[model samples]
Target: MSLLNEKVISSASEQTQAVLSFVRAWLRGEETFEIHTSGSTGAPKRIWLTRSQMEASAQATAAALGLEVGMNALVCLPVQYIAGRMMLVRGLVLGLNLIVVEPSSDPLAALPADLSVDFVSFVPLQMKTLLDVALVADDDQLSSEARARALAYRRRLEAMRAILVGGGPISPGLEAQIRQIAAPAYHTYGMTETATHVALRRLNGPQASDRFVPLPGVETGVDERGCLHVRGTMTGGALLQTNDLVALQPDGSFIWVGRWDNVINSGGVKVHVEQVEATIETLAAEQPELGLARRRFFIAGLPDERLGQRVVLVVEGAPLAEDQEAQLLRALIRALPRHHAPRHIQYIDRFAETPTGKIERSSTLKLLE
Candidate 1:
C-alpha cells in the first residue's frame, strides 16, 4: 500500500473508513468504492465509490485520452477533495509517475524543473492565472525567461494525453483565451461525491465548446425541473440528484444553466444571480487594463420590513455613495429587468473562499450580520 498522507485519510468522520475500504478493495482487485461530496450543494457527505469503478473510469479516460504510462501527472488540488485525491489514484492505477504539490496559484514554482510532467488538472481560477499571465504579463512573447517557462509548460502539456479542468465555471472569455493558446484543456463536471468528474467536455482544439460526454457505463437524465440526475455503478449505482439546472439537448448532451439554489427572490420576482453576475462581468471585461483583478459580487434578498424581500448587491470594495449607487443601478437596469435591479448596494472588503477558491456565500453573508 502506498503511504497515504494523514490529510488524505481524514476529513469528516466517515472519510477515514471510506478511504480504508477503498484501499482494501483496491488491493483485493475489487475495483469500485464510495467517496464524498464537495458540499457545494448542501453539506459534505459520504457516498459510495469503488476502485474498480475508478479503474473503469481510468481505462475509459486512457482510451479517450491516449495517456501513456510512466508520464508524469501533477496533482495540485488537495487530496481531501475527490478531484485532487483521484489524480493520485489515476496516476498510480495507470502507472504514471505522480508528482504531488500543495494547491496554490503557482503550482509549477513548487515543482522541480528536471522532472517532466505529462498531465495536470486545475480549476478555472488557476488556469486563468497561468494562461492569463503567459499572455499579458510580458511585452515580448519570447523573452529569455518567459520563453523558458512557456516552453516548460508547453512541453508538459503536449506530452500529456489530457488535462482535466473543473471545480468552477469556465467563463467564455477564459475559454477563448485557452483556445487561442491551443491548451489541451477539458472541462470536467462531477461532484466530490461522484469521485471527481463523471463527464468531460473538451474546451480546446477543433472540438471547442463540445457537449459533455458521460464516462463509460454512466447514464444521465434531467429531472422535471431540468436539474441533472446521474446514476452509475461507478458511484455504486447511487442515483445522484444535483441542484445544477441543465438544458437537455436532443443530441444527448446537456448544457448547464445556473444552479437552482442560485435563484434570488426579490419582492415578487425571482432572479438568477448567475445571469446578473455574468452581465456585470461582461461589462467589466470590456475594459482591458484591470491587471490581476478579483471581482466578486452577488445578489441577495435582504429581509425587508414591508416587502417580503429586498434586492441587495453585495460587491467587494469600498461602499459607494447613494447617488453613485443610484447611477450605477440605473445603468444596470438598462441591461437587466426593473425588478431585477438592486435596491441596496453593500460593499464588503473581501470574501471568504473555500480551499478550492470558491466564494463561501454563507460566510460572505455572515459579514453583514
Candidate 2:
C-alpha cells in the first residue's frame, strides 16, 4: 500500500464533505438528486431520483428490518453509491442516530469504545472483516487496553439489532462463519434502480433461505427471458426490469441466476456462468486436497471462430502447471455439464475493480492477452 499523504487525506476529506453536503441539501427540501449507475451490465449513466422515492424506500426498509426512530445506525459504505446513500436516507427519514465513518475493510476499527449502534450496513468485504474480528482478534496485535477495545468492538457488532450486507455475493465459507453469529445478518438483493434492497435473505439462522423473499408490498415476476421484474412503493409502483435471470417461485420468491448477458453459448449449448461458478465453489469446499479453496477463479467467455463463444476459466495467481490445469479441467467436466466446461485457462496477477469495488470482469479478462 502507498503512503497516505497530505493530498490524499485532503481528497478523502473533500469526498466526505460532499456526502454531508448531499444530506444537508436533501434535508433542506431538495426534491431531486442525480447519481450514476454501477454499469456492471452496460455503460454507466446518470439518473435522477425524487426525494419522495428515497423516503418511500427508507420507510419500506425500516419496516422490513423493524428499525425505529432514535436508534443508532452506522453508515460504512462509500457515500457515492446507492447502498451508502440509502443509509443516509434511512437516517433522515427515520431519525436514526447515524454514525458516519471512513469506509474501510473494518469501518468500526477506529471508533471509540463506548459506541453502541442499533443497526448497521456492510458489503461482503466489510462483513468478512467484522466476522474475522469477532471470530479471532488475537492479543498479539496489541496491548491489553487495545485488546479490550477490539473485544468491545466485537461485542458491539454481535449485539446489533439488525445487520445488512449488500453490493456483492457472500460466499459459502463466509455464510458458514455468519451462521455462528447471534445477531440477524441479511444478504440483500437490490440495485441502484430500486434505491436499495427489495428482498432479503437471512445469512444465518433457522429461517435462512436460498430464495430471496421480497419485502412487504413488493411484487415479483419474471419476463419472457426469465429476467426479474419488481413493483413496489420504493419504485413508485412502476415495474422495474432487471438484467438478472431468476427462477421465480409461485410464492413470490426467486433464485438468482447469472446476468442475462453473461450466458455463454458454445456450439449451440448455453451455459450459465453462475451455475458453473457455484459448482466449482462446492467442489472446492468438498475436496480440500484439490487446493482450489485458496485459489480465486471466475468463468467467462471469449469469441471463437468455430464455437461462436468458448468458455474460459480465468484464475488469479501464477500460471499453473499444464498437468494440473488438465486435471482441474477434467474435474470440472465431471462436476459441471459438458457444455459448461472451460475451453481455455487464463491466469492473472489480480482482478481489476470499478470505483465502487465490483470486479471488472470483462476488462480483467483482457489482461490475459
Candidate 3:
C-alpha cells in the first residue's frame, strides 16, 4: 500500500470547521501544529507552525490571485504533505467547496462522480496518470461508455480553474501531451520548507514558459553558484536556500537547470545526470537501439578506490548482452565527455521509488550497498 493508505487523517472537529480555525485560535490564538516534513529530501522532522503564519501564507496566495471566498477546488493529493494540507486550509479559509477524496495512484479518477473540481494540485506522477487515464480508449474502435468516460474526464479537466503541479519534474514529452489536451497545468517550484510553491511556471497554452514567475511578495534571486533562493510570506521564518541550480532571467523570473547535488563528478569532470538522462531518453525516442529497457535508470558514483568515484549507469531491466551494453556506452561517449560517461553499466528489473512516486536515488544507491 502507498503511504496515503498507511496513514489516515481523521475528520476535523466543529472548532476546526473554519478554514483558518486552528490558525485563528492559535493567533487569538488557539493552537499550533507540529508540521512534519515529507522526508523525501532528507530526514523528516516536526516543525512548530503558528496559526498566524499559516493564515499569512494562505492570505498571501488569496491576495495574489484575488480569490474570493466560496470558489470550488479539489484536494486530491495526500494530506500529509504541506501542499495537500494547505489545500484544505485554503478551502476552509476561502470558503471553497473543496472536494476531498482518498489519495489514489490516479487522483483525478478517484474524485466523487457527482461533483466537479474547479482548482486542483498534483504531483508530476498524478498529472501523468491523469493524462493517461483520461484518454483511456476502450477496445473495439470506441465503445460508447469508454467514449463517455473519456469525454467526462476531459470536460472535468476543462472546467478546472487552475492546476498546480509539483513534487517532481514533468518530462518534456508529458508536458507536450498536457498542452495538446489543453490541461491548465502549472509546474510549481517549492517544497515543504516553503509552505508550498513560491513560484509557478505555466506548462500549457500560449502562456507556457519554462521560467518560473514569483508569486506575490516572493523575491527571486540567485546565489554566487546561481542557485535559487526564496524569501517571502510562506517562508515561515528562515530564508530557503535551495540546491536547485537555476538561471535568473532579467525579467525577474528563473529557469531551473538541475540540482547542484545531482551534478556527477567523475575524474574531475562535472556532469549533470538529468542532462545525460534527457539526451539518452531523446535518443531512445529517436533511435530505439539504445532504449532504456524500463522506466528507471541512474548515474551513480561507486567507490572506485582508485578514482574515488566512477560514473556508473544502473538501468532497471533484464540484463543486456555485453555487446549491447558496449554499444550504449560508445553512443554515450560520443554524446558526453569520457569522464562523464558511465564506467560500468548495471541492470535491474525495477527501481525503488518514493511514496510520492519520485525516483528515489538514495534508496536506489542503497541497493548496491
The better candidate by lDDT, 1 or 3, is 3
Please provide TM-scores, in order, for all candidate models, with all chains considered together: 0.82, 0.89, 0.83
Question: Weakest 10 consecutive residues, lDDT, candidate 2?
Answer: 1-10
For model 1, name the residue pairs that clash: 31-51, 31-52, 32-50, 32-51, 32-52, 33-49, 33-50, 34-48, 34-49
Our model 3 lands, by Cα RMSD against the true structure, at 5.1
lDDT of 3 by residue, 225-264 (tens): 8888988867765578998899899876899998888887
Tens digit per residue, CA lDDT, model 2, 9-39: 2445645685668777886899988878776
**Between candidates 1 and 3, the TM-score winner:** 3
- Which order, best to worst by TM-score? 2, 3, 1
Off by over 4 Å in 1: 1-36, 141-159, 288-293, 304-307, 320-328
Q: Can you write out model 1's per-residue Cα lDDT over 1-369, one digit (the tens) per residue? A: 233234423432443444445446566776444555565556567766666566666766666667777777777776666787677677768887666666777666665566666678888878876775555434575678777777665555555566788988776677777786554679998876667777889898888665888777778898888889888765668788988888777755777777888877766688777777766666546632321125667777778877677778888877666666666676667767877767668778997776556777778889999
Pairs in clash, predicted candidate 2: none
Superpose all Cα atoms of candidate 1 onto the true structure and report the RMSD in Å to 1 decimal: 4.9
Candidate 2 stretches with Cα past 4 Å from truth are 1-12, 137-153, 285-295
